[model samples]
Target: MQPANLLLLTIVCVLVAYGVGYARSRSLAMPLGGIRHLKSLPFYYGARAALWCGLPALFVLGLWVAFQGKVIQTLVIGSLPQEMIPGNEGEASLLLSKISNVASGALPPSFVEAPIVDASERLQALREQSRFYMSALVVSVAVLAGFLGWVRIRPKVNARVQVESILKWVFFACAALAILTTLGIIFSVAFETVRFFDKIPITEFIFGSQWSPQTAMRADQVASQGAFGMIPLFTGTLLISAIAMFVAVPVGLLSAIYLSEYANKKVRGVVKPLLEMLAGIPTVVYGFFAALTVAPFISDLAASIGIEASSQSALAAGGVMGIMIIPFVSSLSDDVINAVPQTLRDGSLALGATQSETMKKVIFPAALPGIMGGILLAVSRAIGETMIVVMAAGLAANLTANPLETVTTVTVQIVTLLTGDQEFDSAKTLAAFALGAMLFLSTLLLNVVALKIVRKYREQYD
Candidate 1:
């Protein structure tokens, strides 16, 4: 059976186990007096059975899936003749990719040698065998464990403790997985960034003005000893993000305040959803709007004012990005504002404060931390944005602060560097990881500052 189909069958088996256990518990209880006399609830007995039926089967299925590819590849490679064996990891990967394409019929068998064709056939047979064994083993384990659990269900059993303990471990495992994944990403990027610095100096990367990253692939071609200064990318990022925050913060915060405090229910109901609809629109759509409409408008405006501006400029990208993030700030701030104690508002009003005075003195201070959090989210969204920046602000890593000029961000450069199949050993490819590391650090710094502000306000308010 296919793994997906097997998964469905396993779920069905678990449900069946639950039903059987529940029925058994109820029968045992009925002969005595009621479920109150039992050690634990019938629901806990059913849950314990379900956990037993699902957990071991799922664990076996996971292990099989994880190791199946490596085992199959080893078998196929081992079966090949001495002459056909790959010498290195890269060669092995390429050979396996070709074999996969041929097996999948993307490449004709006639195009490759007889040895590869034999290996592909071997690959297919091994995969089929693995799948058959995996399905049978998983199903058998599920059924056996389920039967044991159902048989164990009795009036004297305390299933609740066992079920709760299992659930706590599961939740802890999930949390650990999340933390491990994050650490893995950080360490991977850090290692690659170290490799990048081995080729390119950290001083140049951090402080130099030029931003080219090209390198000669062959001796026949001219070598451009590429510049890897990241100052321009970071400068562009800050410039655009500042513009976006300037546009988003005041407008979004004020809208939130109005929706939460000043606006009547009918107006709030109508306008709030309309305002939040801005967030649901795709970033690419915003990109198109910035490129087609906002860029041209800004250029014409600049020209009419006797100032020169590029058609594809940071101003256009940043402005439209601000519009896109307005809903994020507005919605979050609105919720936070509403969460401020109603007693605070009532006391302020009863003391003869005006509506605006009450909002300013009582509610807004209490909601400051949450409002800052919303704005920080908007800032992060602006910093990480790529599509709108790509479409509206052309990707030139120029070291200039002019909002009217073309520039790029760290994210845009990372995407450009890592877009195609490239050799990771090259400094050109490894530079993406360096830029990503720097971006990560920059964001972490931003979060630290925001957290400090949040804690200060929270202490006062809480």
Candidate 2:
């Protein structure tokens, strides 16, 4: 069946289940009056009933769907004539795929064998019928449970308090899910990084200068010795991030100040979204602009001054990345600046401080924590950015601070390491995970520090 049809069926089943529960509960509670009329809301009873009835059935449906193809293929193979099974595993797998397609009416030619075709037809029909019956049973049970719960409603139940407690638990569960997902990702990265460290000593990976990752194809072949040192990639990331911050922070902060303190309402309305429009531009577009236009322009400018410049320089990539991050910084800073009580700005103005003076001394100081938070967010964006650096910075990992030279970033290295034909267990491939772990940890640390600063400042204001 099509994905859309499956989705529609599932939704219809859930709604039917909810309706049944609602009706059953109403029927049971008809005789009850006053406080005894309801211990909980009718909707709450329906929801609880639906959860119990639908969750298990849906889980079963999901598991069955996942395993059904494999089970069917195994059964079909066992029943097939031994000679019909292809000699090679790959060929056998292909034949099985063709058989499945034929059964599903996706193949042009109909199968010639009567028994095989009949069995395939019967199996498909059975699966569909089973699913339909399961859905109906699940919905019926849900409604029955909801009706029973509704009949049990009474004045003494304190349903409001119960509902509030249930909501708190639900929120807690959602938070746990988010935290667990993060932890799972971290652990997966850590495991692969550990494997990488096993093959190349941690010291070599960390301190080596060159980064040629090519390995010998054969025992007799001369191998271009791989340099696992990560210093160059790390340095490139830092350099680019620094350039981006330099450009974005000042421009974003100044624009935010103008918007919050000086701009007329009409200007604010037109300019804020226009500034935000920069964020919506795709990174690929920025990459081309950096590579084709900005880098060439910089090289020409440098040549005029008698300094050699790379056609693809770090300066071009970093500068464009900075421009990309400006809106993120400005929009966030604007919100935090505006959030600083207007009364504070007014109070500073009333003391005869000029607008600029008030902004620098009073409003800016008051909003410093928030501004820092925005800067930290921008830093994270700069570090994680991939496309601009990959296109304009070139893939040579150079450990240099000179923006005029080409430098590759951690993200670029990670991309190059895992692309094309790759063995997941190899050190080169696993190195990508190590880089990911480091990136995740660094961003997490920055976010934590920013949050603490913001919280402390918030407490002081309160």
Candidate 3:
């Protein structure tokens, strides 16, 4: 049976076990006087039975599914003659691909040698055998464990403790999985970044100004020189991000203030959704708008004013990105502003302060932490944006602060470097991971500053 089908059958068996255990628990109670005669509730007994029926079978199924293909591939490869064995993991992977393609009939068996055809046949047979055994084993284990649980359900048994303990461990496992996934990402990137730094000096990457990364792939061929400097990329990132924040912060914060404090319910209902709808529009759509509309307009306006501006400039991308992230700032700020105590506003007004004065002196201070959080989120969005930057800001890593000139961001460069098949050992390709590590550190630093600001003001407000 297919794994998905097996999973559904396991769920059905767990439900059946729950029903049986619940019925048996109620029957035991009826002979004594009521449910109060039992040490634990019938619901607990049913949950315990469901856990027993589901957990072991699910564990076995997961383990088998994770490793079955590799195990089968190993067996098939081992069966091949000595001359046909792969010398390396890459060769083994390529051979497996050929075998799979032939087995699936995408590739004709006549094109490959006899050994590969034999391996493919063996692979097919082993897969069939594995599935048959897996289905039987899972069903048997679920049934046996469930029967044991149902038989052990006595009036004096504390099934609730067992059930609770199992659930607690399940929740802990879920939390650990999330943490481990994040650490896995960090370590994977960090290892490649270390390899990158081995080929390129840390000082040159961090401090050098030129940004060319083209390198000759072979000794016989002439190619452009490669440089690994990240200064220009970071400068472009900061320039565009600063411009976006300048545009987003005032407009979004004011919109939030008006929505939360000044607008009536009817006006808020109509305008708020329209405002937040900006966030719902796909970023690709914004990219098209920025590239086709905003960039052209900005260039024309600059030319008319006797100023030089590229058709693709940082200003165009930053402005459109600010418009895109408006909802993030406005919606979060509005919620926190509304969350401020009404009595505080009233107390300030009772002392003869105007609405604006109360907002500035009382309510705004109280909501400053959350407002900072929203702005921080908007800043992160601006820094991480790739679509608008690629579409509006042209892909030239010019080390210039002028918003009118064309520039490119780290994300755009990372996407460019990693877009196609490339050798990972090349400094050009490994540079992407190094850039990713730098970006991670930059954001981590941003978060730390924001947190410090939040704590300082939060303590005062509290």
Candidate 4:
């Protein structure tokens, strides 16, 4: 049986075990007059049975699925004649692909040698045998384990204790998986970044002025060993993000304040959803709007004012990005502001403080940490945004603070570097990982700063 089919069968077995355990528990309680006679409830007994029936079988299936392909490939490669064996990883991969195609009837038998045809047949036979054995073993283990659980169920058995114990470990495993995954990403990026630094000096990448990264593939080809400097990209990113935050923070905060404090229920209901609808619109749509409408208008206005502006400028992109991320700030700030104790506002009012004065001093100070968090989230959103920047800001990599000039961000360059068909071994590809590492560190620093602010304000308010 196939893995998917086996999985379905195992689920059916678990459901059956649950039903049997539940019924038996209730039956056992009949002579004693009620289910209260049992050590634990029927639900816990059912759950324990289900866990016993599912866990071991699933563990076996997962291991088999993970290792079967590699085991089969190793066996096939071992069986191949010395002359037919591949010399390197790339050649081995190519050979495997061809063999897979032939085995699946994607390639004709006549297209390859008799030896390949024999190998393909062996591969098909081994796969079929492996599936049959895996299905039988999984099903057998599930049935045996379930029978034992059902047999062990008694009026004195503590099924709830066993079930809860298993569940606590399951939750711990999930948390560990999340931590491990994050560590895996950091290490992978760090390794590639180390490789990138080996190819280009750390000082040059960090401080050099130029931004070009194009490297020649061949010695005879024309290319500038290309600058790996990141100063320009980081500058553009900050410039665009600053413009966005300038546009977003005050507007979003004021809107949140009005909605939470002054607006009636009806107005809040209608306005809040409409405001959140901005977040639902695709970034691509925002990019088109920025490029076609905003960028052109900004250019024309700049020209009218006798100031120079690029057809695609950072101001246009940042403004549109700010508009896009307003929902993040407004929604979060509204919640934070609303979360402030109503008694505090009432106390300020009773003391003869005006509404505006109370809001500015009491309410705002209390919610400042949460509001800061929202702003930090919006700033991160602005920094990471790519579509609007690419469409409106243009990928010029200009080391300028002017919002009216063209610029490119680290994210845009990372996308550009990794977009096309590229080899992972090249410095160009490794540069993307380096960029990712820097971006991660930049966000980490921002989080540290935001945490400091939150703690400082929280201390003051407390």
lDDT against the true structure, per candidate, is 0.90, 0.77, 0.91, 0.90
What's the CA RMSD of model 1 in angstroms? 2.8
- Tens-place lDDT per residue, model 3, 231-285, is 9999999999998888888999999999999999999999999999998999999
Candidate 3 least-lDDT 10 residues:
216-225
Task: Give the per-residue lDDT digits (tens) of candidate 1, residues 364-422.
Answer: 98898978977886788789999999999999988889999999999999999988556
**Decoy 1 TM-score against native:** 0.90
Model 2 clash pairs are 21-143, 24-147, 25-147, 35-155, 39-153, 39-154
lDDT string, candidate 4, 126-225, tens digits: 9999999999999999999999889888989999999999989888988998999999999999999998999888998889777878875666643368
Ranking by TM-score: 1, 3, 4, 2
CA RMSD for every model?
2.8, 5.9, 3.4, 3.9
* Pairs of residues at least 3 apart in sequence or in different chains that clash in candidate 1: none
Q: Which consecutive 10 residues in model 1 have the weakest lDDT in total? A: 215-224
What's the residue-level lDDT of 126 in candidate 2? 59
Candidate 3 at residue 418, lDDT? 86
Output the number of the lDDT-best candidate.
3
- Enumerate clash totals for all models, in the order shown: 0, 6, 0, 0
